[model samples]
Target: MRRIAFLLLLAVGASALALSPQEGWDLVAAVESGNQEAYARLVEAYQAGDPEAGAALGVLYLNGVAYPRDLERARRYFEWAQAKGSGWGSWGLAILYANGIGVAQDDQKGFRYARESMERGYPGGKALYAMFLIGGGAGLKQDINEGVKLIQEAAATGDPVALNVAARYLASSDLPGLSRDPKKAREYWERAAARGYFLARGFLAYDFFFGIGGPPDQKRALELARPLVGFEPAATAVWATALYFGQGGLVQNRPEACRLAKDQAKLQAGVATIYGLCILEGVAPGERALGLAYLALAAAWKHPPAQSLLSDWQKRLTPEEVNRAKELLKNLP
Candidate 1:
């Protein structure tokens, strides 16, 4: 009787195993290959018990890439996947908590789930865990050496974002016990640039334009900057500098330099924006000059050469007049 009962149980389990790859799992495979119809089909065919499908749908809902943005639904799906022990589920949940997206921001919780996913060998979790460690500082007690090591591991696994960040840290003056090696920095930046990292291109252009630790090569700088055109604000400033100084074989063109500076003023947090905000905050017009504007601001504050300019301007006026001018620009209206 016991043998007969065990045989019957085995038969039922075999029948269930026969349909292991469900229709929803197939839909996930299709979605991964960029099949729009298949993705939609998968979303429609997803069953409550399908963890992979749940994780995919959760990501789509979370990002609002195509489907309606639904945080609650995303959370539900992520939770379901978590219940099913999905690595991606844990990783997504960590991101939501870390970014304060549909949840209270909690780095400790984020780190916990991220570490869980990382331990399971999720490459993105590794990168993200490293970023949280690097960026949180005192909140997370940033350990640059440990962060660099983890980032390098992620970058080696072909995380493009990780590649750029690791390269920057390797080149950064802020990393303790890490001596400056421009060539090493350039090497990592080049690796990232090859994978279409626009920011890496911008930094690489700087090295070429300035001949920093490498032979001056303006042509190479221009080449690096060319593909990154229309995207980088700081790159625009660098390009403007090169144009203004005729450095890296660039022809000096004041008009183009002015145009770039004007364009930069429109950008968020650019040097031009700094001047504009300073003016809007009550600094007078022409009180600040463009094109190396800081030099002029320094001069205005009576900083050495700036002091000489202030004295010259004062010679045309009196101390009372200078005090009156200071009073006029004293506070933001």
Candidate 2:
């Protein structure tokens, strides 16, 4: 059987086996960045029955990095790798089942796979399972305390995903006994960013941009944010804000900021507000109507500032302009 062949080949693939989990992931990232040599080596490893390489291949297919996105192929590679006892394989399956990536969403299956991955000492799996416990999304009892405990346990290992989750929990104020602690969140995010977690970098960049939990470091903020502009929405928001305000050594580019926000903002409330503000203040009289339209979307997203701005804009603009805004809103996606 294929599984038997994998087990047998594992002995011959000591090179791949020697890599730590983080190093395996670093190789995947290299391939994702168009390193053909890395990709060739990974493929060679997989052909030689390296479970970690197989899992990395799954990641490539899952995210369309080196290969076109093919969820079914990803699943197949994951299954093969998991059969060989690769934690990354189980983690991939967990994400697929948890979010309905290629098949019907099955929270129970996701939870089971996440547990398997965690048992294998994968920090992402531990953090993921912790989320399922916290949200009770897997048809099980909710255990916020247990979930928080799990996050802390995983974070102690210094994995970026686990650290990011810990930061999120620290930042959340509505969870029963857990008070908001921006300082702790900032510290965790900084650690996660150092480990190359782009989302965490984005958050820390935002914090630096605005002096949250620390003094503003505009230079550092731009350094952390510019590379992530097209990759993470959080970074997009940071870049948009920075460019609009001419902060972080960036040239003031109100028009470019709004342009950057146009498509990316529809789903990001904060970015929508920035786009709306830019349009309102910088655009022509007629185009200003669309600014209110964008602000209205942000208001619908439950952004308090957006709602306040909407009220002010409605009061300041003429009735005709308000009607135009309404028309613009209807046409926006």
Candidate 3:
């Protein structure tokens, strides 16, 4: 308990007041655990149009802290906060655009909004803007040196998002002038993950689980990723797969795994494959027809494993089942 508390404190420190790691958890606990005092304070503050209060609510909706994930709701709240001139809200909207959460991916809008947030003096916004600058995304002029310098500045102030952006760039490949440094990349990623940066946590989980940059450590992957089951796409898929197959030192729990897979389905074909297989086996307590439909969905996304599974599964189905599954797929919104 002491260790966890210490780590939480460290995470809070790294967020630099702009992207607070503690934003949702404590607030959500206060609401869901029925702490009327805390709940009333939040309600009053929000009713009084406090931007921080509004942004905190937006974070709760965005991250599904003690609630069902609802990206549209999060977007609404973020918009409200942004209207009140909260840079934190701008940062949140940038994240939504960058990740296509509850909206179409629009790098131009993302870049514009992230730049706005940075200009408004938000630390997280600086990191976000630098991330876009690093890639020169969406017609923005590439400024690799400027981006790296900005990230270094933000990281010195302990901005976790800045750490994540730097680590991601270093880990991916050698840049035009900068060489890849695996050890530094690992350290930065681990620190950002511990500070609850979504991209860092997810990326680190995938890399560690598969040995992309180093030796695979399945146990470490699960340990880092379990908290992101409903929050980060790739990490959730990794954790759900581990649970489904009893791998990574975890016992099999197909029902739970399928639940996570279903939440993240269609985002990645791997998630669709897991959910489809689980549904077929009744672990998801779903119709075998629906299972085939999901596999078809995955196949449409061009996942090779899903295509193979779909082909193999279709061979065992009657023609009627195949028709029903295809019809269901067509009807899915």
Best by lDDT: 2
Evaluation by lDDT, superior candidate among 1 and 2: 2
lDDT of 3 by residue, 42-128 (tens): 656676666656766776566553456678888988888788787767888898998788899988888878998888776778878
Cα shift from native, residue 3, model 3 (Å): 49
**Stretches of model 2 off by over 4 angstroms after superposition:** 1-17, 22-50, 53-83, 92-116, 138-141, 176-178, 282-315, 318-332
TM-score of 2: 0.68
Give the Cα lDDT of each candidate.
0.58, 0.78, 0.74
Worst 10 residues of 3 by lDDT: 16-25
Name the runs in model 1 displaced over 4 angstroms. 1-125, 137-141, 174-177, 247-251, 262-285, 289-333
Q: Could you give the C-alpha RMSD of every candidate to the true structure, in order shown? A: 10.8, 6.0, 10.2
- lDDT by residue for model 2 (274-302), tens: 88887788742327788888889889875
- Judge candidate 2 at residue 320 and give its lDDT: 91
Worst 10 residues of 2 by lDDT: 171-180
